[model samples]
Target: MSYISGARKVRVMARYDVIVVGAGIIGAAVSYYSAKKGLKVALVDKKYPASGASGACNGGLSYFGKSGKLLQDAYDSLILYRELAKELDYPIEICQDELFVQLATTEEEIAELEKNVEECKRFGLDAEMVSKSTLHSLIPGLSNKPIGGAIAQGGLHGFVNPFTVIYGYLDKVKKLEGTIIPNWEVVGILTSGRKVKGVVNKKEEALYAPVVVISSGFETAYLLQSLNLTLNIMPNRGVVLVTEKAPWKLKKKLMGANFGSTGQNVSLCIEQTLEGNLLIGSSQEIGVLIREPNIDLIARIANNALSFYPSLGKVNIIRAFTGVRPHREEGPFLGEIKEYEGLFVASGHGGMGITLAPWTGRTVALMIAS
Candidate 1:
């Protein structure tokens, strides 16, 4: 059937220029750039856009916490996000987040904090030792345990509604003559020899495309596996809580060493959104997990949030939810996977999808454009 958005029809008999499977942040990113390049692209999603981890994530564009190459990639991706926010004119809020990697109230942790502060300064980032008095000036309710830690100035973060980011891209894609099929769950992938042809949708419609990029999160592995491709993707669930509109005790974002409950060494940070709600999150649990929010975990998050701001105790929690991140055994599998010629991957971001989505979209677009 021919669609008016593009010059051509989606042929069941012939292949399209590109087909992007899974319309999460990464997929939408690819589609946004692909359509902008004037490619006949189709963005197919089984559910709706931002229905997965993309929607459930905190929009933290961070350059703290990360040390070596990861830090560098993060900085590069931030640049891409900055460009996209401007070009797209999306409500991308850039905030200077203050990262306080709390010490464990022990002598060893104090030493390590000093060492980390030194290492961070080498990157032209600031990480100074703060006294309890100094810390209270920034965050009055900060835990009285550890003494001091690092502080990177101009730590830029772009906070937007994840759903907005996806839909904004989708809107631009449509304007650029790209096709989008919501609720079009991909059931089967058609391939001949080593080249991909197309996929069978949930409605039993056979759509043809020469290039396919898998941008789905944990569910991507199953979709690829059906096509004889195995993706080493693991589902790690992170939960978050939001409080009713409260006065801003937090001047900037707050990050600690571990979740208050799990103590999993993951970050538990809180940032007040453009809306008055304060987003408190997140506990990182390994392996494919439960959707039901653990009340105990929520309690821990509340405790941790209060540790950063005692006044937060008065704020009522409006909701609790979880978002899954895709983690692979061989680290993040961006670029092309060698197993398939026309197949590409953009998943395995593991809690950093929001931070990585903009550049990922641009990079994947460049790959297909080349």
Candidate 2:
């Protein structure tokens, strides 16, 4: 037990086997699974659950958009999510059969979409080329500028309410007897001679544990910096626009074929939420970490949405918000630090944090449990 004394009273903090930093989807998953394996766990966050990228993303489980090792990881995560949806009491809308439409405006883009579809199929994914007429039949209000497109259907792709998923994980973690500590900003990792100790929060409270996992999204960089470790993680700001509830015209998620095209400075991805509101987003701006909504980027997003669905012009934008995603030029880092024993890192997921959270959590938990 850890104790604190003051002029008025003394308090004791519960001891834990493992301490998970960040209560977002990843951390929640780590806590839930770790506790499920009979490990005493403590989950700490600067803010409440889903206050980070997990809550801010568009909530797309784009299984079709991924390839290679990332795709394999996504497939494993999808399987885990499927089981969790049924196991959790929370109302998580896991639409596994949802269709994914990648719009193409030019013949060159159409060719690229076809190649992408073939590539997805090569990776054992269910994908096909959809003609313009077939695309219209799928999404009626879509702008007719595109000659053709590609579609991924069946169990290939889907989406979920990110907040609901995070809550579900946290609820399960609690049910497994895990402790949650919120409003505590972790300032440094506690260590002695390269072996992990625990963490020191802003209040200078030393929460000691044998294993410590840093899953604090972009903020992981700063915490590691204090320990003389540098992560290639950088902040990538993305803005999203939510529209007022309207008649849902989309039966599936939609995005430009070039949205997944490499080397693009910005891209547009749209999807209708279960609440009947359409989410228009997002732009990849490097180094802008401020959460303030940018009107200029919002306008661009609106214009891009309008270009795809003219009917979006009739929708009233309810609000605009932004989130900072931890990005690495190489991809996510998901293993123990070589120089430090009992310390692990699981951030730098960028925009795919939601999609990859389950696997990341399981991997990190297994690492600690073993």
Candidate 3:
């Protein structure tokens, strides 16, 4: 047990068994899972849930190309989504449609796609290879490009609504007697020696908790600095375009093999949202946290979308938006901070925030509880 810090004993606002700083998908999951474990959880965020990268990201769960723990965690999260579809109060809208297709326009990409197929088979996942002719027949709105790519079937390889995932998870958390504190940005962590007491909100309110979890994306660095700790995390900005309701049909959620290479790569990812609007994007710019959309990147996304689907040339672009992912070279970090007891972290998910949220949350919640 801990109290308000300093000589002046300020009245503490509240206390919890676990305090999660960030209302994004990861935090939502942690809160929900922790509450399920019968722990009193308080989820705090600067704004609404999924306000950052989680809201802006597409709901694709592509765990096939990942390595080691990243791949295993992602795949496990995919399986969990099926159960969540029935459990969450909100509608997650996990796709019951065809597979997720990655179109390869060049030989280099085709070779990579082949390797991806092999990876899928090695893991007991289903994958299919379609020739250019078959690909055109399979998906109608193509522009005679893309020789053929990999199609991931089964599991939760399709797509889900990003916003809904956050709401659904947090809704369940609330129903489980957990707290949801929005607009309460955690500015400082109140610690006693090497042990965490709780955290200080932006308004300087002390909220006590034995276990404190930090998953506040780019803001995590500032929180870590309060304890003289450091982590290799950076913000990667991605831009996406939303087009008017298309006249034609897009059978599958398609991504170009060219995109998603690393920190600063552009994607030829095109998918139709459940709202029937065509979503196309994106360009990744790292080392910058600007959430504003880039004009040059916007233009490139439009041109690339047109190159693949000529039918979209006349389609009106309704709007554009950007989300910044907290990227780390070694993938996402999820575990207790050994230096400080009762402290844990879940951040640096890169662009795979949506794909890895379930695993990150459940695993971190267990770490704190166990």
Candidate 4:
């Protein structure tokens, strides 16, 4: 019902009920859920889906790595994951064999573990205090340098490939007759007085839609500022290393605030792919150069992995990469943009985008519905 700007005769395309910007996990989820609710949705992105932080992230759903606020969100997100997997019937690698191991290298660290265990239990999570012997029994190759650590049970960790989530959701969106346009960079947001009417793409093509959702991760701030909207999102870069296929006997995934014996602030997590390659990652450097993989940093990650599980030392490092997490100024950025009517945002998930995507999708859909 709206006219396309910069056209010869002002051609008008059918007006869309909702328009989602950025094809990352957040945007895809919004489009998928909105379309499922029978809304005419259009998902547009400058690049292809999963080409941003979603593509570069490690597939860990660890509750231990999450802060207090994110821990609550993670718990809710796990329930949402179960429902999503059932509804989508996709091959989601969700498993319940996740264990958090605290290598207590010092007396203070042991007390910290106790406190974390108590905190977990208070949150209704099943946690257990374990000794050094118990830790070794569970993970035979674990470093025996600690007096004791805490273990949290029933922790659900999954490995949902970002690309799989993107394509799977796209299928659902298409099935609902939703449109997906790639290579359509949003040049400007069109407003009717004080309300949003549509957005102009890079090619000067104006696409009209009543509701516009911005899910551009860290790039959202720049896009919103163009429309005189304020948003604070910072990019935190994480380095991940993949090791060659090896004899895999590590059953439970391990998480520790201390990656190595040096007591550094890093998370050492291990996940073996179906193809036998082991994925290990840690380290968060914000506002760092993200053009190429940092070999020195990735090597530190590998060493940390090996220090915890010596069995991985012999494995060759095949590849290394970095992913940028879109962290909001503080907490999550969801709901409507107060500055512009009809403009909504769902970015700044930090590093838990995959875990929260489904829930955010449903939440945004409800907002658009209302």
- Descending-lDDT candidate ranking: 3, 2, 4, 1
| Model 1 stretches with alpha carbons more than 4 Å out | 1-15, 92-129, 259-267
lDDT of each structure?
Answer: 0.72, 0.81, 0.82, 0.75
Ten contiguous residues minimizing lDDT sum, candidate 3: 1-10
When summed lDDT is taken over every stretch of 10 residues in candidate 4, the lowest stretch is 4-13
Query: What alpha-carbon RMSD in Å does predicted model 2 have with respect to the real structure?
Result: 3.4
Of the pair 3 and 4, which is ahead by TM-score?
A: 3
Model 2 TM-score on a 0 to 1 scale: 0.92
lDDT of each residue in 145-222, candidate 2, tens digit only: 778888988574677888888888888888888889999888777777778877876656777787898999888999
Candidate number with the higher lDDT (2 or 4): 2
- On a 0 to 1 TM-score scale, where does candidate 1 land against the true structure? 0.87
Q: Candidate 1 or 3, higher lDDT?
A: 3
- In angstroms, the error of model 4 at 281 is 1.0
Candidate 3's TM-score reads 0.94
Better of 3 and 4 by lDDT: 3
lDDT tens string, model 3, 1-370? 3345843244589989999999988889888889999999999999988898888877677776675666678789888887887877577777745468888988999998888777777777777777888778777768878877778767567677878888888889888999999988887887787788888865567888989999998677778887788788888888889999877667577788877787436778888876678889887877778778878889988998788878788679999988888888788888888888888999989878888888788898888888
Clashes of each: 1, 0, 0, 0
